[model samples]
Target: MDLVQLDIKGISYSQTQTGAYALLLSEIGGSRQLPIVIGAFEAQSIAIALEKDIKPPRPLTHDLFKTFSDSFDITIQKVIIHKLVDGIFYASLICKKGKNEKTIDARTSDAIALALRFKAPIFTYKNILDKAGIQLKTSTSSSQTQSPKSKVETEIKSSFDLKSLSLKDLNKLLEDAVQNEEYEKATQIRDEISKRS
Candidate 1:
């Protein structure tokens, strides 16, 4: 099947699932959108990469892996959202090491995060998009169906640091974070929980 390229257009909290985030993938040549629900940690990983914030004291696992690949002179060409099975999205990383091309199975979240960090294109099997993407009645209608200034976009820009908030406030903040696609705040909250335990 042919692959259709996609870009990460927006993310939001999943109304259908508690404590999960919905990632929206926008097709490059179409108005269809594919939404995948991912956990908070993965959401944060992708968000941090997207925001281009590299100030963490230690490298994140994905960062470490990317560093390792770079050190070995491996190049990530692109990432592919290859399949959707039983409502789950599947992805792969396309890498080039010397004269050989390698494909690695990857969680969709991880693949997307790496693709952003590597400045690589993301492709999805056309079938997957057809199966999972929400089709609109018209391209113009879909374009105006949601604006860039939607609630998620607004919240992403105004999110607060989770470490500075109390547990009670964190709960409320989580709601806002999900709405705004502030995965960094959500990740910080998860870390705070681990630290308190």
Candidate 2:
């Protein structure tokens, strides 16, 4: 199968899954986009890698991997999203050192985070994109949409104040947040509940 080159178009908070994010991979010179749902920490890692100015005080895991690879004179040549099983993506890192190459299996999210840090190009099989890519409507595609890294914040906001809720209500809300997998909200609720305790 021919490999279709991809670029990280954006990353947005998942509308369907709480505490999950949608990482948009756009086919070069094509309309279809591959949306991979990733976790919050992974999303943040990718976002930080994308924005050149925002450096974390500490090296993230991906950064450490990059540094480790650099110390060994290894370079990531590229990343391939090789398989999709049960809605999960599997990727492999194509690494090279002194003419020796290795293919390392990795989760799609982790692969992407490392790819960005390595400045490695990303690709997926044409068949994979054909099987899973979603086409967008005219008005809200690609450039028309806000950056997913930024969109991650706006979609998670709510109006309810945790301070006003009673212990019982707070616990109930915490339960709902966990059930919904809104972990960010759950953390906030958990903190408030902790304070009261």
* Index of the highest-lDDT prediction: 2
Candidate 2's residue-wise lDDT over 1-197, tens digit each? 89999999877676546788867788998976676778999999999999999988999999999999999999999999999765668999999999899999999999999999999999999988876665443444456543443222333345447787778776666555544545445545555665675
Can you write out model 1's per-residue Cα lDDT over 1-197, one digit (the tens) per residue? 79899999877776545878878777897977666778888888888888764557888878888899899999889999887666667899999999999999999998888888789999998877765555433234545554345544354346634455566655555444434555434444434543544
Every candidate's lDDT? 0.72, 0.78
List the candidate 2 regions with Cα displacement exceeding 4 Å: 139-197
The per-candidate count of clashes, in order, stands at: 0, 1
How do all models score by TM-score?
0.68, 0.70
**Lowest summed-lDDT stretch of 10 residues in model 1?**
135-144
Candidate 1 global CA lDDT score: 0.72
Off by over 4 Å in 1: 137-197
Best by TM-score: 2
